[model samples]
Target: MSSPPIITSSSFSSSNPFSSLPEDVIRAHIFPRLDGCSLASVGCVTPELHSLSSDHQLWSHICHSKWPSTTTSTLTHLISSFKGGSRSFFSLSTLPPNHNIPSPSPSLSALPDQIISAVDIFYRGKCIFSKVQATETVSGWFKCSPFRIDLVGPKEAVPTPISRPSHEDTCQNLYADLELSWIVVDPTGHKAVNVSSLLPVSVERHWLSGEVHILYATVVCGHVTCSVEVTCVGGGPGGLVLHVTEACLKMEDIDGAHLNGRDSLVVLQRVLEGKRGNLCSENRKMGKVEEGRKKYLEFLERRKERREKILRREGRLDNLCVMIGSFLFVGLFYLLCFY
Candidate 1:
């Protein structure tokens, strides 16, 4: 058997694959299937395809398709407000958040007066909930209180196919499969950041209440952390199906205290500008998730070290105080005896 000649980008002699296809077919049928990175790669192939791939509609479609929650009117407006429109927003949300670099965070004014959160949750590939929530950051109460964005109202719950589990094994079996994407948009900064770990870092079922809490977390700046907690309760038809009653984002410092609104906004702004540390960047290697988990572990260690330092400093202070008190007592007794 004879070997066939290798097919290169120019192998077709006169016309390439892109040149042979009708532009409409590629634009309408083909380009939409490619994700942002794939679309960028396709653009690099040739000049003709590059033009088609550059279509704002295609990038916008990719954004909407990946995160359905962006279709809301408010979210749509925010997306349009991004510097390069949807393409810029998409790039911001998908890139790795390089969070641990040693640099001062931006001022609170970097945050918009109003911020938008587009959250999506999936269990077993089915979208359980998608919502866009607006939060007021300009108020005094927000600046002084603990920072939190509640995606679900207290009275309502989003029902799911998952049933309440009677045993611990059954309850935790689905933790690894849950997916979440939480993108926070600051319209004033013209930037957005994905604060979700893309998968559950931990899932717990309340022992007495039986409420399942699925937690997606990202370690911010090595010492700080951002987390989205989905609290699912049993409900729907005799309370058999799992109902997600609450979903919220919370930021915490090394002491585990909830970051106040002012502090939280600063961290958020830094996260928006930080470099995404993606050490495990191989395909199917759980890229960002693994990196997130690793950073979380490091954060724990740093927290421990901080506590130890504080304890050691306090111990030294306590010893010094005791020595001073004993010396004063001895000197007073000697003076009284001598007199």
Candidate 2:
């Protein structure tokens, strides 16, 4: 019988269609289609793919898409600061850092008392808006709240219901309080500026859901104040997800101010008055008593569940201690009797 020819590794290598394509073609056509997460994963497969994935152009596209408000100057500064250029900057800016490191006890004094709001607006599940704002504003009405709508600003510090003690908890809670204010961030400058401060705005409650709706104006140029409307909704599994549903911007010329001048205070006063009237009309159609009742009931249910969990854990610890004490007593009695 004649010996059969063996299929070598070289034969399989030759079959890969990607190997035949030029590096430029792969970089331009193939890499562009992959998202940031997908691109990072693909880079691990081969050295050639790794080089193409690190291209600044790919990361620049991702950064702009995620943060449309980011200016060109800010983007350039961010890229220069990071070793991996735009890729490293984008990864650090968007995602939270790894929490696995061991550390000494943190001082309570060093802990941040004021909360920062990072609002991400999504349209049909796609992120369309993102901004970071500080909660400590001159207008006490604009501060962050534990709940979606805070008609009267909170008097005392309320424990955040959504924060988890550890990552091991299977059911994760979303930080809904951070959705209250819109803060625009400059990553390169490493600063957060409140969107409301730039132009005066008012937030009104949606009749059916009690969600907040904001109407504001921003200076587009020397001539105009761009009117914008923002709406927030509770979404995702466990009703923990909070995101912006709509953000519509329309340009209107300044009325009282100079025709070719940007006067923010003047623009703010005009927008607030217009939105206030609309809020009153919407409020009349809805029943206030029903809204308050439903919100209280939901709060009680969550509080009850939390209390029951703590009691159950205490009960287990008490039983364990009792068992140990009984065994110790029995051993001492047996020794005395034997002696």
Candidate 1 stretches greater than 4 Å from native = 1-18, 101-104, 107-109, 275-285, 319-339
Candidate 2: pairs in clash:
132-183, 133-183
lDDT (10s digit) by residue, model 1, range 1-339: 333223234632255554577779878876776667677656665676668777878888888887899888888887887777887787778754665756676765566787789998877877779998888888899999999999888899888888787855446667666789999888777788899988887888888898888888888787788988899898988988889999999999888889989778888888877655322212533666787877877887888998999999999999999999999999999999998
TM-score of each: 0.86, 0.38
lDDT of each: 0.79, 0.43
TM-score of 2: 0.38
What is the C-alpha lDDT profile of model 2 across 62-90, one tens digit per residue?
66665553335544554556567667645
lDDT at 288, model 1: 66
What's the CA error at residue 115 for candidate 2, in Å?
A: 12
Report, for all candidates in order, the number of backbone clashes. 4, 2
Highest lDDT: give the candidate number: 1
